[model samples]
Target: MAVIPVAIAGAPYEVRIEAGLLARAGEHCRPFLRKNRVAIVTDENVAAEWQAPVTASFDAVGIASDWLILPPGESTKGWEQLARVVDWLLALEVERKDNIVALGGGVIGDLTGFAASMVKRGCGFIQIPTTLLAQVDSSVGGKTAINTPAGKNLVGAFHQPSLVLADPLALDTLPLRDTRAGYAEVVKYGLIDDAPFFEWCEANGAKLLAGDSAARETAIAKSVAAKARIVAADEKETAGIRALLNLGHTFGHALEAETGFSDRLLHGEGVALGMVLAARFSARQGLMSGQDAGRIVAHMEAVGLPSSLKALGLDCSGRRLSDHMLHDKKMDAGTLPFLLLRGIGETFLAKDVDLNEVAAFLDEELRG
Candidate 1:
């Protein structure tokens, strides 16, 4: 087991990456088991596979849990589910001091954390992220959100988890598609600040997805530590430091919006293509070599990730796509900051981006 500390101001937390932690979840959660009961919010898919081991673990420690399972999908991250989660927690009488357990993927963790944030103004929550994407990114960051008709994650909160138990073994059950999606975010950490880590991912991502326990653990630990350090420095994204984490999010979110935030493109898939776009766009701006941009795209392709806008088969104009950026939460002072790369491991925020130019670029990409 490895512990990565997130030193968020006024609320510190730890992310535990280990194998088989699910079976012993109760032991680790004992210290925070204030009510001898926990409210768990998960999706049907996760419950079907993991509910038994998780429930048995908590039951073994004499901790009771009120389980709320919703349908599994990106669509579940919305107002309806958010309301459902809040009502369930309220019915369970979960107090502000009580900790809710988020036991699933990113959608579950985000919705549950958002629910915990609003219920009684703020209840604690623990993350037992069962997916690779959730384990390395959504579960550790305090950023919890639900999507609205307006945009993805437009309605959300920054509710930090009191404890995060990331069991790589949980990923063993993930479908190859989901595992590949999660690997996109894992690669994001390397692109944002660690060139060597990116190289490591390019080499070992396949093995990790193939259920290499050692590779999985190493990726999770490294990714969590990078996120922990970034979250600690700028938890609220006030100083733009945390914005580094959004390396591929802008382009990815636009792709998500284009796809109606559906199964057509998973969040991490959009990010995979988004990072490629960011890299290519950086080259467009003369900040980097086209060869470097190609390298980024090549890596994604080799790893079975969507590597270009052309590959997604969307029927939309670049202007229409760039229009979605207008709704991005990162827009500030009437301009959105594009996270562009000077090269792998060197990402910077470009606040001077012209949406019109972005529209033109997207149009070209569509034509390509």
Candidate 2:
């Protein structure tokens, strides 16, 4: 097992990565729970595969489990589901000190963490992220949120999980397409500030996705560690340091919004394509060489992830997509900061971005 600690100012936690961590979740989560009974919230799809073993694990440690299995999808991350989770926890009489468990992917973690943020003025929650996307990025950052009519993750909190248990074995159960999408996020850490890690990914990403356990564990540990260092320095994104983690997210969110946040475009898929665009956009602005940008595109295409905008076949103008970004959570003071690359592993927030120019550039991308 690899232990990565997130040292936030007031809420430090550890992310434990290993094989079969799901089967031993109760043991790892034991230290955080305050009672014999724990509340677990998972999506119906995850419940079908992991419910029995996780439940048995808790039972082995003399802890009783109560589960609230919700429908599976990005649509579930909204007001209705949030209300349902909170009411169920309230009915269970969860206190601020008691820890609840969020099992499954980003959707479950975001929804359950937001619900925990409200229960009894803020209860603790554990993230047992089952998907590669959640394991590598969403589960570690302490940034939990739900989507509103306005945009993705527009409404949420900075409530960190009490603990995160990531099992690479979990990925074995994930669909290959989902696994490939999740690889986008793993590639992000390399793009943010670790060129060598990016190189490592370039060499080993295929093997990792091919069910190499060692490769999966190593990648997860490294990604978690990179995020831990950044989160420790900028726990709430108040400083510009943590914003680097959004390397592909700005354009990616716009793509996701255009796709209706559906299976048509997974978050990681949008991000993969977004990073390609960011690289190309950076090159277009003379911040990086076109060769470097093309390298990003080559990598994405090689991995079978989306790397082009025109291929999505959306029926909207670039202005329409950029308009979606207006509702982005990163918007501030009527300006939206973009995560542009100076080069691979060299991302900086450009606060003076012109959305109109963005629209026009996106128009060019759409035409291609």
Candidate 3:
């Protein structure tokens, strides 16, 4: 087991990574609970696979697990389900000191955490992220939100979890496509600042995706540690440090919105494509060399992630897609901050990016 500490001021926590941590969840969570009963929030898909093992683990410790299984998908992370989760927790009489468990992918974690943040003003929650994307990205961070009609994660809060249990074995149940999508976020940490890690990914990403246990553990630990340092330094993103984490997010979110945030494009898949677009766009702006951008494209394509705009088969214009970005949370003074690469592992936030230029670039890509 590997433990990564997120030193958020006044809310320090640990992310515990292991292969079979999910089956022993009760042992880890017993310390945080004030009662023998706990509330667990998950989606139907995860509940179908894991509800039995997790409940049996809790039952062994004389704890009762009360579950509220939501319908799975990005749509679940909205105002309606948020209200339902909050009402369920309130009905369970969960107090601020009580810790609820979020036992699925990002959707469950985000919704439950947002619910916890507002329940009686605030309560604690544990994250047992069942998907690769959640384990590597969403679970550890205090950022929690539901998507609104305006934008993704537009309505949310910074509510940190008490403890996070990320079991790589959980990914064993995930579809290969989903796993590869989550791998995009793993690659993001390297692209943001760690050149060596990026090289390691180039060499071993296939192994990790092929179910190499050690490689999975190493990747998850390194990714979590990178995020831990960033979150600790700039928890609220008031400082520009945490903004680096949004490397492919702006473009990715716009793509997601264009796809209507459905299974047609997974969040990680969009990010993989977004990172490629960021690289190509950086090359276009003379910020990075075409050779370096080609390397990103090659790596993404090697891993079976989407690497081109034309391949997405979107019927909309580049201006239509860029229009979706106008509502992005990163917008400031009518300009959106873009994460662009100077080279591999050399990412910087460009504050003066013109959406018109971005639209024109997208038009070029779409035409290609």
Candidate 3: residue 21 Cα off by (Å): 0.4
Question: TM-score for model 2?
Answer: 0.99
Candidate 2 residue-wise lDDT at 96 = 89
Off by over 4 Å in 2: none
Name the runs in model 1 displaced over 4 angstroms: none
Displacement of the residue 105 alpha carbon in candidate 1, Å: 0.5
What is the alpha-carbon lDDT of model 3 when measured against the actual structure?
A: 0.94
Query: How would the candidate models be sorted by lDDT, starting from the highest?
Result: 3, 2, 1
> Which stretch of 10 consecutive residues in model 2 shows the poorest summed lDDT?
141-150
lDDT of 3 by residue, 77-175 (tens): 999999999999989889989999999988899999999999999999999999889999999879999999999999899999999999999999999
If scored against the real structure, what TM-score would every candidate get?
0.99, 0.99, 0.99
| Model 1 per-residue lDDT tens digits across residues 202-221 | 88988998899999999999
Residue pairs in clash, model 2: none
| lDDT (Cα, tens digit) per residue for candidate 2, span 8-47 | 8788889989899999999988888889999999999999
Clashes of each: 0, 0, 0
